[model samples]
Target: MNRKVIVTCALTGAGDTTGKSGHVPVTPDQIAADAIAAARAGASVVHIHVRDVETGQGSRDTALYREVVRQVAASDVDPVINLTAGMGGDLVIDPANPTVALEGTDLVSGLERLVHIEELRPEICTIDCGSLNFGEGSSLYVSTPDMLREGAARIRELGVKPEMEIFDTGNLWFANEMVAEGLIAAPPLYQLCMGIPYGAPVDAGLLQAMVNMLPEGAQWTSFAIGRNQMPWVAQSILLGGHVRVGLEDNLYLSKGVLATNAQLTERAITIVESMGASVATPDEAREILKLDKVA
Candidate 1:
C-alpha cells in the first residue's frame, strides 16, 4: 500500500444535483469556501466546477471562474486548484432525425472550451479524453481526437497539468496514445472515473483492468458516484493510487445524513488513516505530482 496519498475534494460538479442537496456549492464564494474547508479537512487538492447561481446549472463563464480562484487565493489555505475544462462538450441529439442537434447540445471547438483555463491558468485542469452518451437521455458528451489533440497542446503551452478524465477503457486507450504521441506531457495524470452511466462499470475487476493498462509512472485517482463513493476510497488506496470526494460525486455522509464538503473530506481522512496510510499535505502533494510551482 502507498503510505502517502493525495485526497482531492471535487467541491462542485456540473450536475443537476443542487436541488437534491443543499450542501452543493453554487455561488463563487460558496465554491471557494468549500475548497478552503476541504483543504482544512485534509484534502491536498480541490477540483472545481462553477454553476450558474440563478439556474444552478453548469457554466463555462470565465468571470465566475475568476471569482472562485480569487477567493481561494485570498484564503490562507492553498490547496491545489483544479478547474474543470470538461464543459462545452455536451451533445444532445434529436430523437427523430439523429442529424439535428437538440437544445442541450453545447458543442464548441476544443480551444473554446479552454477559455477559462487559458485565463485562470490554474495549477490543474480536466480534459475528458473521449465522447460518450453522458446519461440516460438524448444527451451525449463529445471529445473527439482532433479536439483532444488541440486542447492537450494548448494546456502544455500554458504549463498546467491536464487531469485526463477517462470514463471507459477505450478512453484510456486513447489517453495512453496521446501521451505516446507527446500530446500530453510525461507522467500524465489520469482520473479513473467509475460508475457513470453507459461508460465503464464501477467494479473492482474493471478498475483493475484500467489500472493495469495505465502507462508506467502515471499519477492517477479514482471515484464513483452515489453510495459507491466512499467504498472506492479504500479501493483506490489499496490499488496504490489517490482518491477524490465531495458533493460532486456524493451528497450523503451516511444513508440519511447529508454532508458538507468538509464533512465528506473528514470522512475520507478517517478511511485513509484507518488503512495505515497517511494523507499528503498541499505542499507534499505538489512535490508528489512533480509540479515545478503552484499557481
Candidate 2:
C-alpha cells in the first residue's frame, strides 16, 4: 500500500460542544491558534466553522468567517483552509403545527450560505450531499436536491473545490447523481460523515458500503463523530481512504480525558504511521485534494 494519507483536522464544529470540552476554541484567536497548531502537528487540511464568541453557538455571519479565514491564512502555519457551507439549512419543524417551523429553525437561501465562500474564496468548502433525519427528535437537516445543486454550482463558480459530505446511503447516491448532472467537478471529493444520529453507523460494513457507492476515480475521506472519531482514522486509511479528526467531531483523547484539536490530529498521525501509512504534508494534501496553493 502506498502509505501516504491526508489528514484533515476539523476545528470546532457548529455543534454545541463549548461547555462540554475544555479545549473547544470559541474565540477567533483560539480557533486560529488551534488550527495552526494542528497544521504543525501533522494535519494537511483544517476544516473550519466559526462560533458566536458570546454564546459559543455556530453562526453564519460572513464577517465572522472572514476573521477566521484571515487569521488562518495570515498565520505562520500554512494548511489548506476548508470552510463549511453546511450551515443555514437546519430545519426544526414544530411537531404540533407541522406547517410552522420551530424557534431553532435556521433556513437561508443557497446563495446566502455561500456569501463567506464568495468573499474569502478559500481553496475548499463543504457542500452537504443530501438531507437526513439528524436525530430521533423533530430536527431534520434540510439540504434538498435543489439546494445541493445550487450550492455545488456556486462553489464551482467560485473556484472552490466542494467536499461532498455524505452522511447516509441516500446522500451518497445523490452525490453520484450530482456528478452525473455535471454539478460537481470531475474526480469528486467526498467526506463520509459516519456515526451521526440517524445516519450511517460506524461499523465496518456500513463504511464499506458507503465507500462502494463512490463514483470511479473519486477521492474520499471518512470520519465518525464522538467516540468513533479516533478509531475511524484507522478504519478509513485501512480501507484506502483518507482520515479526518479534531475536537469538532470528538472531544476526548481517551475515556474521561478531554483532547485538544492538535492532540486529536497527532493521534491520527500516529495511527497512520503505525499502520505503515505516512501522513501527507500540507503541500501533498493540496495536490491530492486539488486545492489552490495557500495564499
Candidate 3:
C-alpha cells in the first residue's frame, strides 16, 4: 500500500443539488465554513464552486468567488484552494431545431470563463478537457479544444496549476495532447471524474484504463459521484492515486443518512487510513502539487 494519500473535498458543485441536501452550501459564508470544516476533518485540498445567494442556483459571479476565497484563506483551517474553471460552459441546445440554443443556456468565451481564476490566482484551478453530453436530454457541457488550450495558457500565465479534469477516454487523450502541445507544464495534474452520466463508468476496468493512459510522472486523482463516491476513495488509493469526496459529489453517508462535508471527508480519511495510508496535510499537498508559494 502507498503510505501517503491526499484527500480532496469538492465543497460545492455547480449541480442543481441545493434542495436535495441540507449539507450543500449555497452562500459564500456557508461555502467557506464548509471548506474549513472539511479541511479540519482531513482534506488536504478543497475544490470550490460558488452559488447565487438569492436563488441558491449555481453562479459565475466573481464577487461570490472572491468572498468564498477570502473567507477560506482567512480561516484557521488552511487547505489548498482549487477553484472550478468549469462554469459558463453549459449549452442547452434546442432538440427540435438543433441550431438554436434553449433558454437556460449559459455559454461564455474561454477568457471570460477564466476571469475569476486570473483575478484570484488560486493554488490550482480545474481545466475541463473536452465536451460531453452532460446527461440525458438536450444539455451539453461544451469544452472545445481551442477553449481548453486558451484556458490552459491563461492559467499558466497566472502561475496557477491547472488540474486537468477528464470525464472520458477521449477527454483523457485530449489532456495528453495538451501536454504534448506544451499547454500544460511539467508533472501535469489530472482529476478523473467518473460516473457522471454520459462520461466514464465507475468501474475498476474503466478507471485502470484511464490511469494507464496518464503521461509518465503525472500527478493524478480520481473520484465518482453518488454511491460510487466512497468506494472510489479506496479504489483510488489502491491504484496509487489520490481521492476526492464531499457533499458536492454525494450527500449521504449511507442510504437515508445525510452527511455534512466534514463527515464525508472524515469517512474518506478512515478508508485511506484503513489501507495503511496516511493522509497528506495541506502543506504537503501544496508541495506535491507544486503550487506557487502564497505570499
TM-score of each: 0.98, 0.97, 0.98
TM-score of 3: 0.98
lDDT of 2 by residue, 1-295 (tens): 3379989999999888899987999888888999999999989999999999899999898888888778877878888888999899888887898888887788898778898899889888998888888887799888888888888988888889999999989999999998999988766899999889988888999888887888888899999988888888989987889999998899999999999999999999999999998988888888777776635
lDDT of 3 at 174: 96
Q: Which ten residues in a row have the lowest lDDT in candidate 3?
A: 286-295
| Candidate 2 deviant stretches above 4 angstroms | none
Among all windows of 10 consecutive residues in model 2, the one with the lowest summed lDDT is 286-295
Candidate 1: segments with Cα more than 4 A from true spot: none
Residue 280 in model 2: shift from native, Å? 1.0
**Model 1: how far residue 181 lies from native, Å:** 0.8
Q: State the displacement of the C-alpha of residue 140, model 1, in Å, after optimal TM-score superposition.
A: 0.3
C-alpha lDDT score of every prediction, in listed order: 0.92, 0.88, 0.91
Better of 1 and 2 by lDDT: 1
Task: State model 3's lDDT.
Answer: 0.91
RMSD of each candidate relative to the true structure: 0.9, 1.1, 0.9
List, residue by residue over 219-249, the lDDT tens digit for candidate 3: 9999999998999998998888999999789
Decreasing lDDT order of the candidates: 1, 3, 2
